[model samples]
Target: MKKLVISLALCATNSLFAQQNWLGNTSPTYEELIAHLQQLDRSHKEVKLYNMGPSDYGQPIYLCVVNGHRDSSETFEKARQSTTILINNAIHPGEPDGINACLIWLDQWIRAGKPLKSHDGGDLPVIAFIPAYNVGGMYNRSSTSRANQNGPEEYGFRGSTKNLDLNRDFTKMDAVNTYTFVKIFQALDPDIFIDNHVSNGADYPYTLTYISSMKERLAPSMQALTYAHCIPTIKDYCQIGNFELFPYVELKGETPEEGIVAFNDLPRYAMGYASLFHSLSFTVETHMLKPFPERVKATLQFMNATIAYAIGNAERIEIARKEAIQWSQAQTYFRFNYQMNEQVKDSIRFKGYKAVYPIHPITGLAQLEYDRKQPYEKYIPYYHFYISQDSIAVPKYYIVGGQETKVIASLKANGVEFQTLDSFETKTVTCQFVKSYKAPTRPYEGHFKLSEIEIASSEQAILLKPGDILIPAQQERAYFIHAVLQAKAEDSYFTWNFFDSYLQQKEYFSAYVFKAQIEDLLSKNPELKKSYEEKKALDIKFAQSEWDQLFYIYQRSPYFEQTFMRLPVYELND
Candidate 1:
C-alpha cells in the first residue's frame, strides 16, 4: 500500500509540472518566464533558447530562436537568406503584456509543430525573440509603477538598473542591455524589427496599434511597399484575428481628436535605429486602459499578423531591402536634423472616443474625461512629411584623434568600418570648428542634447597620430557614421555629452597674468590693437570690464588651444 502511494505521488508531481503555471493568464516573474522558455526549447527541436548576454545588474538576457526548417545551429545561415523577423518584448518592463503574449504564441506554435514557410521555398524565416529586453528592469518588479494600467497584479519598473530608460539609450548606448542588444541585432541582421510596448496617453477604441518608421524617411525602394502592401496586409490580418488595429495615436493635450502628428524617431529610438539600416521596423503599442489579458491577446494577434505578413511578402521585402542597400552604397551625402514640412500633409482616418475638459474633485483643476458612449471617426491631418533642413557631405574616411576613446568605442559599437593609422603624420584636412551650439535647459533622455549648432569649416594641418581611427563612409554603416559624427545631428555623440570635456577649457590663465599679456599683445600688433579698441569703443561692457578685455585679448592670442573647439573628426576625400 505504501509503494502504491509513492507511485501515485510521483504521477501527481509530474502532472503538476506539466500544467501551465508559468503563464497564469498574466505577467510572470523573470525566473518563471525563463523556466517556460527553457521548457519550450527542450520540448521542440525547431525552437532554441540562448542567453544573449549579461544585463546591467548581472542578470542574463535570453533570446528565443524559432526556425521552421531544422535545429538552431543546423539552419541559421539558411534562415538568414530568408526574411528574418526580430521581436523585442518588455523594453519597459512595466508593460508586461508582450512577455505573456510571446510566451503564449511560442507555446501554441510549438505545440502545433508547424514551421514558417520561406519566400525562397527552401528554408523558413526565423523568429528571433528577445523575451525581456530590459532584464534588470524586469526583475525589479513592482505593482504601483503603472498606476493607470489595468490588471497585471504585479509588474516591473520603467527604468533599468541604473535608472536609465533603455528606449532612449539606443543611440547613446549607456546601458549594458543596449550593448548586448547590438550583438543580437548584428547577428540576426533581421529584415523586420518589432518592439512591443503599451500606450500611456489618451484612451482609444483600438486594442492594438503600431508606429511604423516614418514613411518619408524610409528608403525609396521600400516607401511604396510599406504603405500599399505591408501595412494594409497586417491591418487586415489583425482585424481578421478579431483585434482592431490602427496607426499609433499621438495625442495633444490629452485629446487625441485634436489631430495627430507623425512621431519623428531619432536614432535614439529602436525604430529609428532599424531605419538607419534600411530594415522595415515598427513599435507595437497596446491600449493601457484595457485589462492585462486583453492587451496580451491584442499583442499576440499583432505579432501573429506581423509574422504572417512577413512570411507572405518575404520575396518583395527582400528585393526592396537589397535594392535599398545597393542604393545606399552609391550615395555620397547624408541628411540630418529633419523638421516637419507643414506645407505637405497626408490624411489618416482616425477613430476615437470623445473627451471633454472637467474640473477634478481632488485638485480642483480642469482634467480630461473620456466618454465611451460617444465614438466618432474622421479624417485628420497627419503631418507625416519631413524635410532634412541640414546635410553633411559623406567623406571617404573620417580620422578620429587617438585620444577620443569614447568616440572610438561608440563607432565600433555601431559597426562603423574603420582602421587605425600606422604612423604619426601631419596632413592638411578639412574639419569643423564648433562655433556655438545650444544645449537644452532641461534634461531629455538623461542628456542635455545639443541643438541649433553652428560650425565653421577650414583646411588646417593636423597631426594624425598612430592609433588614430580612420572610419570609411563607403560601407553599410555610412548612415550611422554620418549621423553620429556630424555636429548638427540632434542625436549625435556630441549632442549626447560624450565629448563634453572638449567643450570646457582644460587650461586657463589668471586675470592678473592676462592683463600684462594683453598689454604686450596690443602694443606689438597694430591690426590686433585697432580691432580690440574699436570693439571696446563700440561696446560699453567691453570697455568697462577689465576681466572681459583681458579674456578677449587672451582669446586672440596663440595661447588659446585652436583644437579645443574643433570637432575631432577630420574629413578625407576619395
Candidate 2:
C-alpha cells in the first residue's frame, strides 16, 4: 500500500514537471492531463474515467466522474438518482486557468477525503469534468495567441486542430470535438454545467465573473432557483473568499461603463447549449489582464463555491431538472432568435476602473484606455433579459435521406433518438424547398455560413430508403431538435453549411439550347412571360442580360434539378 502511494506520488511529480516545462506556468498539457487523471484513478477510489469519442486531432476526450464509490456503475447510478455538476475546462486552450484550477481542486478534494455531501444528509452531487476539452488546441501551443493575457509565458492557441473555434461549433457540430462533446453532454445530463473561460474584451477590477444561461430561456422551474438561490449564494461565497464577483462584463463602444448588455449566447456557445437542456449553466470568465497564477486561484475559488452550492441544493436541482424535462416534452412551441430587452431595466453595481483616451504613437489617433489605479463603483443599468423574437411550432418527426451522411453522423453524436428505415417506403411528408439563401461574404470558422434563409414547403409523397434516418420531435431533447432542424435558427446545420449541396444547381442547360427553349417556355405560359417581363422591367440587370433571361426561363422549365433546392430532412405529419 505504501509502495503504491509512493509510486503515484512520483508519477504526479514527473507529470507536474512535464506540465510546467511544456506550459511554463502550471497549465497542464494533454499528456499531463492524462497522466494526472491516471494518478487520480490510482490514488482515489472515488475517481472514474469515461472515454468519449475521438477528437479531430485523433485524441480521445475523457470525463472524470468523481463520487464516493469505486464502481463505475454505482457512481453513475448515484449521479442519475441525485444531482451532478459538470465542469468543462480548456475549451479555448489559450484560456487554461480552469485546467490548472481543476487539477488543484482535485488534489485538495482527495486530501480532504472528498467530504462533499448534501445538506439533508443525502448523497452529495457527483462531480464530473472534462480535463481538457480541446486536446488539439492544447497541443498547438504558442506564446503569442492571447496578446492581452499576462504571465502565461506560453499557452495553447485558441483554435482547435482544424483551426475552428469549438465554442462557435457547439450547435453546428462542425468539429469532431464538438461531436464527441455532444455525446458526453447527453450521456451525463448534468444538473449544473460550468464552462471555464478567460475574458479578453473589457478590463475590470474583479478577478472572477461569469455569464449565466439566459434566465428567460431557462425553464420556469429552474429559473427561480438559478436567479434567486444559486447565483446569490455563489456570489456571497466569492465575496467571503476575498474574490469579488459580478456578471460577465460585456461592453459596447470600447468600455463597460457605457452600459453593459447580457451576452447574446446563441446556441453556438456552451451556456446556450446547456440552456436547451434546462441545465443551470455558467461561463466562468476570469480577467485576462490578471496574472496567470492569480487567475487560476480565482477560478479555483469560484469552482469551489459552485460545488458547495450544488451540494447544498442537490435535491432541489434534481427536481427542477425533472420538471424541466417534463415541461419540454410537453412543449409544442419553442422560441428562438433572441434579442436583448433594453426597455426592461435592471442594474448591477459594477466595480471597474475609470476609462480614458490617449493618443497612439503609431496611428496618431486617440485610443481607448482604462486606468486600474482609479477604481470606481457605480450602479450601472444592465439589460440581461432576452426576448425571444421568433418561434417555430414543433414538427412531428424529421426524415433524413441516406445521402446526408454528415448530418446523420451529427445526429448520432448528439444522441438524437433516431431509427433507420428498414426498407424503402413512400409517405406523405411536409417538405421545405429552398427558394434562396445567401452565404457570408467571408469564411467564418472555416465555412461560409448561410444567413439569409428563405424556403417554401408543401405536403408531398416522398420515398425513404433503408439508410435514411427518422427523428421524432417528442423527446427530452425537444428544444435541441427544434434548434437544429429549424433552417433559419441562428446556429442550425443549414447555417453551418451542412446542406451546401442544395445551394448548387447540379443540372443546367446550355445558352444556345435554352434560347429556343425559352421562346417555347414563355409562349405556352402567358403568366410566366408576364412575370418575366415584370421582373425585367423592375430590374435593369434582368432586362440588360439576355443570358440571365434565358437561364431564368430554363430554371422555370424542366432543366433545373427538382431536388436541387430540397433539404435532406423532411417533416412527417402526426
Candidate 3:
C-alpha cells in the first residue's frame, strides 16, 4: 500500500510537470501566462517578475528576469551592468511561439536546477523576456485572425485594443505599450535583444528564419560582431539541435524561385529600435505553415543558442557594444535613407517549394500556391547589400520647440539626455523648411504617413522659450537622436506624421485680400520686384494669372507666416 501511494504521487507530479511544460500546439492566454510566471517566481529564487508599466489595455505589462541578482532591484541593476539577453514576445500575439518557448525554457531551466553557467562553463548572461507584450491583443483572442498560420488552437490578434500595430509604434510611440516597452528597454539596457515573430509569405521548408539589423545602419564593431560571429555561431548551434535556420524570406519577386532580399529594419521596428542603442538585435520569424509546436521548439532552440552565444562571448559582446556606443558618440556624419543595391547580389542555398498556379475548383480562377511535393534546393540570389542615399553632418545640439510635447515625451522615453530651458533665449540655429512631401490617401496604423519628404535648411536666429529641449548629439543614443530628428530619415518624426501640423498653412490670406498688398510689398523690395518681373516674362502661367502673381508676391513678402511649413526641430552645428 505504501509503495503504491508513493508511485501514485510520482505519477501525479510528472503529469503536473507535463502540463506546465508547453508540449502541444497551444499558447497560454494573457492571464494564464502571467499566472504561470507568477507561480515560477514564487517557487524559484532565480526567477523574478516585475510589473514594469501599463499596456494599452490598462493591464500591467510584466518583465520576467532569469539568472539575475537576489532581488528585483538588484536583478535590474545587474542586467544593466552585465551582459544580458532580452527576448520580447507577443508584440504580434498571433505569433505566440515565443511565449511558449519562454515558458518551456523556464521549465527546462528549473528542471536542470537552474544552471547559472553555460555548457562551456562560462557565466550565463541575465536572461529576460516579456511574456506577452500586446496585452490588449492578448485579450482579443481568436483562432481565425491568422488565417494562414497552422495550429495555435487559439491566440491573440495582431493589433492592440486601439487597433494599432504595436510593431510600428516604436519610434512614434503612439501606443501606451510603446512607452512601457521603452521603459523596460531603457531599464535593462540589454546587450542583446530578440523580438520573436512568425512569417507570412511564400512556402518554405525551413521552420525558422531570422532578421538581423541592416548591416549598413549598424556601427562597425556591432556589424562585425553580429555578422562575423553571433549569427554564424547561432546557426551552428541551431544545426546541432536538428533544425535549419535561414534569413527571413523578404522576396525580391512574388515567388521564392525569383529571389530573396534582406529586410530593411527601420526605426519603427522593435529590433531596429534596439539596434540604434547598440544592442545586438534580431527578429526571429518562424514559418507560418509549420506546426505551432514545431515552431515553438525552434524558437526555444534559438533562445538557447542566443543565450549560449551570449555566455561564451560575453566579454567580446560587451567590448563591441562599448566600442559601438563610443563610435556613435564620436561620429561626425550620420548616414541614413538606405537603399538596397540591386546590382550587387550574393547567392545563398535556399530550400523552397515550387510555386504553382492552379485553378481553384470553387472559384475557377488560377491562384498562386506552393506545391509541397516539389521541394527543391538551389542557389538563389540574395540581395543583401545596401547603400546610404543620404548623409547629414552631425550637429552639436538639437533644439526641439516647447510646443512639441509628444516628440519630447518620445525622446525622453528612449532615455535621450537633454537640457530643458528655464528662461527664454535666442540663438542662431539651422532650421528646416518643408520643401515638398506627399501624404498617403488612406490611414495606415492610424496615421496618414508622410513620405517622399524634401527639406530645405537655412540658418536663422530662433527664439527659444522655457521648456524647449536642447539635446546633445554626442551621446550613447546619438544614432536614435539622428534617426528621428533628421527630417528626411525613413522613419523620422516627419515621416510618421508627427509634424503634420507644421506642413499645413495655418494662416492663409484670401487672393482678393492679399492682392491689395502685393504692389506695396514688392515695391519695398527691389529684388522681389525684379524676380516678379522675370517670372512674368519667363513663365506664361505667372504672366497670365493675376491671382498667381499677387499670391507669389504675398508668399515672398513678410506678411506670410514664417513658421508655416517650418519644422520645430532646429540644429546647432559644431
Best by TM-score: 3
TM-score comparison, 1 vs 3, better candidate: 3
Clashing residue pairs found in predicted model 3: none
Q: Clashes in each model (backbone N, CA, C under 3 Å)?
A: 0, 0, 0
Question: Each candidate: RMSD to true structure?
Answer: 3.7, 3.3, 2.8
Q: State the C-alpha lDDT per candidate.
A: 0.80, 0.82, 0.91
- The reply for model 2, stretches above 4 Å from the true place, is 1-25, 68-75, 116-122, 360-363, 511-553, 558-560
Model 1 per-residue lDDT tens digits across residues 1-574: 9997986676446334533532454588888888767866765567788887889979988888887335344335745676888899888999988888877787666555555554455435688889998988888887789989986889889899989989988778888888888777766778999999999888778887899887766678877777788889998887787767788887533477566777888888988888788888899998889887788888888888888887677889999888877777678778777888878777878777888778999999988778888888888777777898877777788888888887788778667778998898888889888889888889877788887788889889888889999887778876677778877787888889877777777788899777777777888888889999999999999899988888888888888878778888789874
The residue-by-residue lDDT of candidate 2 on 439-503, one tens digit each, is 77899988898876887888878878899988988888887888888887888888888888777
The weakest ten consecutive residues by lDDT in model 1 span 14-23
Global CA lDDT computed for model 1: 0.80
- The estimated TM-scores of all candidates read 0.91, 0.90, 0.96
Candidate with maximal lDDT:
3
Single out the weakest 10-residue window by summed lDDT for candidate 2.
68-77
Backbone clashes (count) for model 2: 0
TM-score of 2: 0.90
- lDDT by residue (37-56, candidate 3, tens digit) is 88777766788889999998
Off by over 4 Å in 1: 1-25, 68-76, 118-123, 440-442, 510-530
